[model samples]
Target chain A: MMQIVKPDFEFKKVYETLYPVIFRVAYRVTGDRALAEDLSHEAFIKYYERRNPLPDLKQTKYWLIRVVKNIALNYEKKKLREKKAYDKLQFKYPHFTQSGEAEFIKEETKSFVQKALNKLPYNLRIVLVLKEYAGLNYKEIGSILGIREGNVKIRVFRARERLGKIIDSDAI
Target chain B: MCPDNETLSAYFDNEIPSPWNKRIADHIAECASCQKRLRQFETIKNYLHEDREPSFESSLEQLEIRLAGLKPRTERVSLWKRRVAVPLPAAVIAAICIMILGISLIFSLTRSNLRTMSIRRGPSGTTEVQVAAPIEDLELLLKSLDTYYLKQEIIITLPEDSLFNITGEAMMFREAEFSRKRE
Candidate 1:
């Protein structure tokens, strides 16, 4: 028989222990602190709603990280669609500039490295973020992304190469 | 041939296996180009890590508050919704439609199966009632004969005997005059 568990002391402990790392992964992937916070909360809520806690904290962390990856992928897709629509509008209205608040948010939230990471393709960026920010090995990242370990290694290397070029060119 | 940058990167991450890892390590020790590539990977890794950790205190508080109000749904309810409610609404509706269709078909069939009833006055100054309904319906009709007597246009011209004929069954006659009783 499967037991349904509530969010108890064990859950709170896991949340505290993993929140920082989860937030870091979200932020690095999204490059926006507010959006990262939202995504992190969404991930944890999903975990809490699972009703059956993973056997241990390590498994819980992996589950939460996987959830965050899925949520962030959806967010990236929506953002891409919005950007395309905005670009079309911009083309029609040449004098229109980006909203000041949006500009401010981007400037405030995006770090130099984050900007470089964003320049990499989504696939490479995701693997690299998992590798560096989530402290996941290539095998772990591959497991989360549903790809092979070898594919993960190549993506991480390619991400680093592109990121290095972006940083050197930007001279930041 | 020299190991490509990908192999060096994998070597940097210690993902390469033993003999190849040893070979790459020896090659990097001797090769300046590979060493520079490895250093560049290191620099990039360092750059990625340099971003200061954002404060999560408020976010954690918000999550805690949200989690406080959330109750764990029972496995039964969750499974029910997931398996039966969410994906099978169409199936449920289809089943309901089929049942309704079946019930209506039965009702229509029963209505069609019921034979018509005829009551006529004979040339011998007697009345005859012919019924072709089922046994059950005949019982009910006999029970409700008083209401049907008032509703149906039944007339007997003579105060004589009346014959009752149940088709595909026995015939019964009442010597009492049905017209005399009505009068």
Candidate 2:
């Protein structure tokens, strides 16, 4: 007989084991802990809604990471559009002031490394995040991002180089 | 020629294959510039790793509570996979076929049993009647005719196998007669 529903205990165990990795990947990719939490919740909700559970925890982790990656990409695009619009508005009205809370959050939440990570191009930043935070190998990262392993390696290197430049300039 | 930083970085990550890996190692060991570049990659890796992952204990708790409230959707089984099951389309077609067969059967039986009655005057000036139908249908037809028509001496011809008896002014169908015929 086919299994209809996965038991709740089994699901809970998987959730506890994978939550940290999922949240870390989301945080590193988006550079916002709160957004990361939201993304993590979204990913788990998707997992719970699936009719059939993946065979094992490793596959489940990969599946959740892929969901978070796609969600974060959409968010990144939206953020970019908003930033472009904001920049346009700022150019139009030179006297408009940014919200004090926004400035405060930026100063308080962003570490030097995260600020540098944010400066790298989106493609390079994602590859580097998977490498350093998720601890995935090049082939795995390539599989997750739909790029070749060699491309993943080159992106990781380029991201590191750019990040180093940004950090060094900031330090100076 | 010295390998590029990308190659060195791949080498640092142990991503290069056998002979190239050894070759890059040999080059880095002898070359000061390559060594400095390798160190830069190491420094960058350290810097990325140094940023600690923030604790998400409360978030995890909240997520767990949310998940606890959710029930996983039951897997949908295809009709083909279900045992002793007919697909919805096939069952609908079968029902329509049965209904059509039943309706056509009823129509054909009704047509075969229909009777037309004809009344005419004979050369001798007396009325003559003719009807060809099943006995049960003839009895009903006669009962519905006007009493003026029934007053005349009428004749009804039934099938040889039909069992019918007419006795009184009112032509009534007896259930016992039909039941005996059926038996």
**In lDDT terms, which candidate is top?**
2
Candidate 1, superposed: residue stretches over 4 Å from native: A1-4, B72-183
lDDT of 1 by residue, B78-121 (tens): 54345334457888898999998788667655554445475554
DockQ for every model, please. Answer: 0.32, 0.39
* C-alpha lDDT of all candidate models, in order: 0.78, 0.80
What i-RMS does each candidate reach, in Å? 3.7, 2.9
TM-score leader: 2
Q: B146, model 2: CA deviation in Å?
A: 49
